[model samples]
Target: MAGFRWWFMAVLVVACWMKGVAGQARQQQAPAIWVFGDSLVESGNNNFLRSTARADFYPYGSDYYRGPTGRFSNARTFSDILGDWLGIAAPPPFSDPTAAGNRIMGGVNYASAAGGILDETGQHYGDRYSLNQQVVNFETTLSQLRTMMNPESLNQLLSNSIVVMVFGSNDYINNYLMPNIYATSRTYTPTAFANLLLNRYSRQIEALYSQGLRKFFLPGIGPLGCIPNQLATGQAPPGRCADSVNQMLGPFNEGLRGLVGQFNGGSHPGATFVYGNTYGVFGDILNNPGRYGFTVRDKACCGFGQGQITCVPLETPCFNHDQYVFWDAFHPTQAANGVLAQRAYSGTTNDCFPMNVQQLAQVRPM
Candidate 1:
């Protein structure tokens, strides 16, 4: 009996070691991610188009990705951060031909600069890529995936993939902020306007959900009114945020939470919606800029607010980027983006929802 017990213990130890090795191997298999959204996801698609949304120039991707070839931001965006956390390289830009080889095992960026949910929004506005076009791009990529891999492999890709989105601010800024088409011609009150915008957004979300996408990380609005550009125009308090514009984002976020609830309760039990509470994250930074290593809270780090001094212009180049929360009046600096990405994954809400970025990550199909 003693001899038999000793043999059994040795067998158990070897089995445990083998199981640990298998688990480590599985972890090495990184999950693929499909990024879909607005200018935030723009990986130089705008450079090809005849639009002012182009970023295929200097100082854009210089700090991180480097060289004019890397036009998407300095280091990487939220999607890249998430991909890193998952142990995979950030998805390559869709325009890259090498994407075919990488995408079969990884993901793609389908975001277009100035993109919107409706096709007509971009045409009426001047430059943005309408959300419809983004969807078209997404579908095209899906076809490419189909051509590259078998059905079983494709299904595996779909099953393990994550999709992220950050949008709606463009519509507010371009249409609602100054009281133009959406408010006057469309006749929308603030509350009604939010509802209408959300309705359009819901349609887009539903369409994506229909396409076998179960994991979603959707960002809510940030402190838009406090942006350097907006502050330049509004009467901002010293070291504090403006109420009128910042307040608007709350209702919008609330409406989004309600929408997520509806989606979760509907037929798509497999679908998980994680709300990116960017507003709270940005607010935290605004409320305590010093804590986050920010100094220039009112103006862009790279732009001249007084006159024609822009961040990228020949005469008006950036001096110190770390002091500024925004690289420009509208966009946050890479540091800010990194903080927001961390906050998204952690789900540490300042005053938003129960789900954070980390919670949202688990929204994949079983």
Candidate 2:
């Protein structure tokens, strides 16, 4: 009976893998969502490594997508919602032992919790993939595509792929502020730091461009000062966003947008890069929760110490996720994610500068 059970399990795994392949066989304009970012889009992708940044436990996936699969959110992530809006499968995390190249033509999420644009920014997490490392992971996926499809087919797939890059918040919070330490805080002024990040960012996107990622949707950081964790950590006044920390994002965002403009008009000619107005969209939501059908915006839906501590597997989250903007100290509720995705997909110039995600997807990259 034991031997029979083991054999049955193997067969089931194989069956599931086959089913995944069939899904990828669907005829679609966009072949995949090759995502590479931070915790906002990760889905159990961190488990394959020995990283302390694992979230494959309970209460993490409370709102949807079955049990916790290492997503940094309590429910679906920004990538998940965006994938749904695009009518493509959310990229499987390359970290999944089962995510063989055969099952990932639709997309794969390589975002990791505690990850940052700079390799050393989120080192406090102990073992998270840096932005550079995530790009390396994409190379692994690219090699697989080379084997699975013809050269023309691979190029076609990649040219149409919507490569999403969401990062930057941790560089300030986790790196500069935490413990009031890290060399970055003392080494560079705000302008220098922003420039530093932008310089490295330009290189990173160029790496993606070399990999044939043409349609780029880069979401900037939201008001990190407004997050419950930031508030609690700083003991700021009730419901007030942090003024000092919030100020940092504007300069960084300017740098990011400028970088995108350069990529579109210069180095990567013909690439369609749309910068998601993440800060604006989320700021409006935070300011007018009632307008968005919410009652709570100050606290997280889950966690202890009134959200100072994030949710553990056994701790009970709030009964209403829709009412809260945050699910934990640093992440948003799936409800907020859905709203953000909708805006990013089709919202006008105010929501996505230059063009929206849908527009980027529909048009050809040079």
Candidate 3:
């Protein structure tokens, strides 16, 4: 009987060990989220840069649990909310000191405030990382990952990961629109400028694809015309948005949708490109604010001079942030971001073209 008891104990130990090994394998194989974008998804990367566009102050993160973590929103950004829905922890910014070694296997966010698709788009801001630079940083992450994971495992991890990219707004806001500061407006018409951006953006996407990234979620720029910054211009009729600015964005959004279709139509093997209809979603909210539980859509929850300026450091913001759509002159409040992230994660064709993030997450690599 004593001999039998010893054998049973040995069997139990081996079984427990096998269970732990399986759990570890599953954890390693879990899909991670790699984020790359501009201010809308900045996450705190700009804190590490010597940029004037930094947001590491109070009122910026008043509603966030960590309080002023460099996020441009009052709480979580769009990518942060989306990551919550996916059950994936938001990755540390690529520039963070701790984002190295084994910690990188979880993922990395390369988003920077004032960033844009074109390198020169937001140069006036000082020290912003362009989309090209973000991609380069991603390559560096891939290199470090290669040291820890075999080529096959690394490729598998990357191919299964979801990449979120939000850009192009700054190209219009900071570059083309500011004709005195940038020659792009003088050099090209709105259509031509859109084409130029799409061309550059296409190259960036292809570059990422070449690096084994297969699942991409690209959220199109929202209605900049409706933001407090543009509305304060007095360029529109009373109770209306800056229609001229909104018109200029149409071609860009259309071209972006075309790019998604092109990518999925055999431009890149095993690639699943999903386009989030940010314009449509935000427009719907603007047109029907009450439907989305928002009371103020035309103004910002926090502003300084001219109602277009961003929230001043340590300045007090509106108490009812959830009722307000715009957080500052440009970004959305956490409440609005939650709605946008929810729709992008699971909404139908009207929200995200082809498939939503939830659907894209389930698709196996071709």
Candidate 4:
């Protein structure tokens, strides 16, 4: 009887793996979602690289995918969430230009961990990729896609698809915050620096629009002032956020919001911009963590006192995941991401909850 039970359990596991998840097989006719931007969307591209921003190690994927796929988080991310919502597999790695074509059945996550829009040098963050490289890789991926499908099919794919872009964390955190070896080390007021960033960001968005991408979901900065590492190192009153850091993010988000509105309300409507109020959602979580059923809202779960040391499982494992908002000093936990995803994909920008998954899907192509 014991042996029979063991065989039965094995069969059940195999069946789950074989079956389509989130209605993937049922929604075979839906269009693909093209993901772009930074580490927030990184499903596992860093595993192939020799970078420190890698999650291929243990405890990262132990929660969701069950094993290491090199994700830089404790479990599945927004990219994976989008896949589940779309009933298809998440996007493939940017390293493999042919990956998008291979996954032809689902969306593609072109986001690389540590990538940014304005910084093309790839030196801002160690072990992190650049935004330009992601776009370049995407061009190759698109060419491969063109080869795999008929002209009509390709056109349909582009027209019916959605593009999600989320970035700017590294630009502020790595380049502007701490002067890396490559920088000239100039001091400019936060306003000046933000203007510079916005200018560069505008150019990148324009470039994407020219590429026939008509549906855009651009997420603004989250609570940058609340991250454990930043708060621990930065000068702020006890229980108070670093107002200066959060201040800079507003201008950047404002510029993006204006651009989104321009495209959405313009005469030559080539793309529909869907604004993702990351700031609002993250702020809500921070101000009232109990609303989300979180216990430790101020400090990270894995890090040392006030989040100074390694927050990895071996170094210091968290006791209760759902009770904590942040998984590490830098990133949010899986449950937090799940809540964020639900908010991002559920309604119109005017909705009290901000943009949601359904609203993002409703973005009509140019």
RMSD of each: 9.9, 9.0, 10.1, 5.3
lDDT of 3: 0.90
Position 227, candidate 2: lDDT: 88
Q: How well is each residue in 175-268 modelled by candidate 1, as lDDT tens digits?
A: 6665545552257666776787788888777777776667777778777788776777645676555677777767778898778767767567
- What are the per-residue Cα lDDT tens digits for candidate 4 across 27-145? 63347777887767787776677666666666666577466566656788766675566555676776644564457435567677767766543463365567666676667767877
Per residue, candidate 3 scores C-alpha lDDT tens digits across 39-67 of: 99998888998898988998999988899
Output the TM-score of candidate 3.
Answer: 0.91
- Looking at model 1, the pairs that clash are 114-128, 115-129, 116-131, 302-311, 304-309, 344-357, 345-358, 347-356
Q: Give the TM-score of each candidate.
A: 0.83, 0.90, 0.91, 0.85
List, residue by residue over 1-366, the lDDT tens digit for candidate 2: 999999999999999996774554343546678788877888876777667777777788876758788886777888887777676877678877778766788877888877887888777668888888989988998888788999988888889888889888878877866645588878888888888888888788889888888899998889888888888866467659887878877888988887777777777766789888899999999989998888888888877534565677767888887888888877888889978998998899999989998788888766
Query: CA lDDT, every prediction?
Result: 0.66, 0.81, 0.90, 0.69
**Model with the higher TM-score, candidate 3 or 4:** 3
Candidate number with the higher lDDT (1 or 2): 2
Structure candidate 2, residue pairs in collision: 44-69, 91-107, 91-108, 91-109, 92-108
Clashing pairs in 3: none
lDDT of 2 at 236: 67
Output the number of the lDDT-best candidate: 3
Off-target runs (Cα >4 Å) in candidate 1 are: 1-30, 68-74, 96-98, 122-127, 180-186, 235-239, 305-310, 349-353, 362-364
For candidate 3, the 10 contiguous residues with the lowest summed lDDT are 21-30
